[model samples]
Target: MKQSRLPHRFGKERGRNKMDKFMDNPWFVRIVAMALALLLFLSIQDLGNKSEGSRPNGMESNEVETITAVPLEKYYDSENLVVTGMPDTIEVTIEGQRRFVEATKRQRDFTVYVDLSDLSIGNHRVPILYKDFSEKLKVKVEPVYVEVSIQEKVTQEFPVEPEFNNNILAEGFEAEQPIVEPNRVRITGGKETLEKISYVKASIDAKGLIEETIKRDTKVTVLDRDLNKLDVFVDPEYVTVTVPVNNPRKTVPIKIKQVGSPPDGTVIKRMEGDIEEVMIFGWTDNLQSVNEIEVEVDVSEVTKDVELDVPIKRPEGINKITPERVKVKIVTDKAKNAETNLSEVPIESKGLADSLDVEFLSPVDGAVSIKVVGNKDELKKAQEGDFEVFMNMQGLRVGDHEVNLEVKGPKDIKWELSTEKAKVRLKEKGTV
Candidate 1:
């Protein structure tokens, strides 16, 4: 039996029958099934990778983002109470759909703060809170909870001392006491913190080597006894400072001050120093008498030829020196050594009070004998005026006392006193 064809079914029946026949083929069926399965797997993979940021979703950091240095606002009784232990900034993490996350991070229209208006004076552990942001976004902040200290507000005045790095100044220069326009500053903070304030410094700043005077506007800082900075409100937070950096220099030579003796049968052939012109830094008047800078060395332990780095000692009146260390090459050789005895050298008394008169009791002539020992050639160059014998009578009163003998002489030769000390009697100038 044959079926009647439908209207407009001229090619419709043949197309449908051809499609049904094609589906019945095992090879064609397998190919179509494989294509559909592949399409489904691609769709699932695209969805799974959306959060990994592997592909751009037309937004920056589409899935999650971390915002740093977000200011942390504090809400408390600012007028009557002081709070501590809260950080000035926080780290906020925003996580949600790509659109919301990108919007929140870009706009940055959120607040992370702590509210302590309802609390009393004491320490309390409270959770940090946030507000004024998109509700669809999930927010997380580091240090979710904090321990805060609440105390009575107090205000006090602290003297502002100026501080600067004098070491950074130009060579052979000095910085005088810094002068602050207003020497004092007013600070407000917790009672405990105010009481712990130790230093209020107006730090002065300069660029590179400061040769001339420095004048600038700088901020004041409050610190505790341990030099730890304190968080507080300062009135007139800024101040003007003037630092007088002066270059009062004097050119001089270096003098070697030897302390010990050389070994027997060994003579110092020559001592050559690798130093040139030197500078002494100080006030104009203090630099007047500073003719040389002393560098001390010990020759007692020196047996063979060796090099020594001697530190240049700053004079009592000088403020600074150039070439802090001088490298010296010492040459030693075996030669004939001799000793020269200097007798009847008058001893001088220094640092004696003007109202007192000193008289040597044992050595009535106030004279001493010394033995200078060194190379025969070096000893021949020695002179009586080259050495100074003196006794420090700085703290002597109107009574008898024993004083130690000190010497100032050439450094290449070794010298010693016949007696270590001298007996002297001090009397009032007007007394018998």
Candidate 2:
């Protein structure tokens, strides 16, 4: 290239002098290089700022909506996993790339696991592992290791064979002892899970088992499957079973036990009930001790009624009563009265010494009412004097007599005696 202009004498001298200075002081040359590099960096930064401004603000991860995944159950160490410590729920946090995290509908899609098998017996720290991430997305779990303590495996023996613990079947119905193909099962787990175990229940629920031979593979399970297993290592796997049921039918008799008396002036004549016997159906063991039959009636609130209800009652300690109800009828009747009239009747007194004198002061005719309780036939013939009515007159001479009389009677009779004041002339009778 042809030189367009001649070098100035000062420029040439300065350039030459600068080259010499750089060669003499290397540190000065390094400082100048750094200054140039900083200038270039600033220019590039400015260009980037202009480009981003042309686009839009908040277009990065902040622009998109964020969603997180939460687990339903808590994660715990396996072998030593304390059932109590194990959480019923777990959660997965997804952020940064909102589209990728929100699009994952299930927790399984983003593999989440705590390696329990690798855990030691004692307390341990475990890390949560995650992978496959781009620059735009991120997982929040930094220190993924979680602290957990492992426990020893425990085993327990439970009766695997099914049994009807003293339960009786109704007549013509029997339980076919279940034959569990594998009688006993081995269950191994943590202590917490083992402690919650209930009875391992296996059942053969078929009707009409009396005198019948049946072969079936009954389904069996641990009562608390979450805690225990069906232990079936005992004899008689697939329970080879037999049932001996009898068609049991029996008749029973019932009686009554009277307690308190009826109200005063009232008597219970007839007490009736709904039934005398009740029918019962149950296992022989349950029905063996049954003796009495009872029924309930609305007699508890009975005060005044010609006909009162009598409820049947079952005696205590009886297993079952046949003819569960019965009707009891108690017949009752009202009392009757007997009357007598005596006109100048003789008043003969007993237990009187011969030294005393006696006379009749009142008119002999007197009326009295006598009440008696008995069958209708007996009361009709009952009489007043037939019982006894008397007054003592030995101490007085002939005189006007006014006195009330008392009457005595047999056990079944009641009596009342009354008369108007008597006016009899007085006279001196011979003294003793």
Candidate 3:
């Protein structure tokens, strides 16, 4: 058995030696290495395929994002059909691979719209639709549907009125008829909406108190009679509004008013102001009510003939009084200065309440005798008609009150009242 096994072992060793020689050969080594490499490559490809197949449709893990305020659009016959009651915006949510979700959110190149083309003039409920986005994204919108109104479109030409802020005018200025470059506007809207149109106006832009004429580019606005805003499209959406500002002027006489009494025994013979008339600047409406401006002069300490400078006070609604100061010459003397009485001067009420009546409690007759002193000859010519006596009851109420008396008389005459103050009672009308 040993002898037989030795021959077999010898033969096996010889075969192994042959096999080792074959393995040592470069061509044989190259072929075997290639075969092993091919097997490894094939195995790797199979494993890769299996790994990829394990995933659903070879997609990566999913991600989600929400996009807000996506604008909603409509498709309709805009020339003839007007649609309303559609949401201006909607929210869109998308879920997909992380890369796609991020890209879709970043790009935001999508449109959410409603189809109104097939619908007639009426209300309809429709589903919101979207396009221009990646198909791989699972997109969902917050508002899936909208109800809209369709109406027959109508267009009409309406006169465009110009609206201005009169408060913006300068103190002495007035606004003229505003001129619009295109005085009329063409508005397009639903027939029913157009029927409700009441005003189409362009508001002039006034940055400040306007002193001169100006032209401004202003947008057009449409509204109903109640001033509620109406939705419509106006052709030539902007127009130039020409606002002409007029500064009216007038020349009026200036009156020198005397306050306070002169020295004892002294009487004013003549009071003259160098500024006889002044040019006034103000609105035309205000100028209509003014005929003269007054400047007060005090002659309490004036003893002899003298000249003095007095400042001018601009009355209400008078923008400017030219020559704010003036020279007044006062002549006073004791000669021919005698006081005379103007009797039974009836009292007049000023600034009294419309719902109340007043009674002079002290002078029950509401009459007073005043002493007028001038060049005695002039005093003879003065009468009760030349004087007006009253008290300011503007802020007085129902009560017993003592109020000072005010007198308006000839400029040259000095008047002394019988009483400096009068007691009065204010009671509501139609009462005892």
TM-score winner among the candidates? Answer: 3
For every candidate in turn, the CA RMSD to the true structure comes to 18.0, 16.2, 11.5
Q: Which candidate has the top score in lDDT?
A: 3
lDDT per residue (tens digit) for residues 309-337 in model 3:
99988888888878889999999878566
Q: Which candidate do you rate higher for lDDT, 1 or 2?
A: 1
Clashes of each: 0, 52, 0
lDDT per residue (tens digit) for residues 174-278 in model 1: 788999988888899999889889989999877799888999898999999999999889989999999988879878988766667677666666676798658
Q: What is the lDDT of residue 153 in candidate 3?
A: 91
Mind giving the per-residue lDDT tens digits that candidate 2 earns over 232-309?
222233443334344443555444544454333334455655455555544555457666443433332333444434
Q: TM per model?
A: 0.45, 0.37, 0.64
Judging by TM-score, tell me the better candidate of 1 and 3: 3
The residue-level lDDT of candidate 2 at 398 comes to 52
- Model 1 spans with C-alpha error above 4 angstroms: 1-62, 248-286, 290-432
Misplaced by over 4 Å in model 3 are 1-54, 57-61, 167-173, 205-214, 264-269, 283-285, 303-305, 331-432
Estimate candidate 1's RMSD in Å. Answer: 18.0
Which pairs of residues collide in model 1?
A: none
For each candidate, the alpha-carbon lDDT, in order, equals: 0.86, 0.50, 0.87
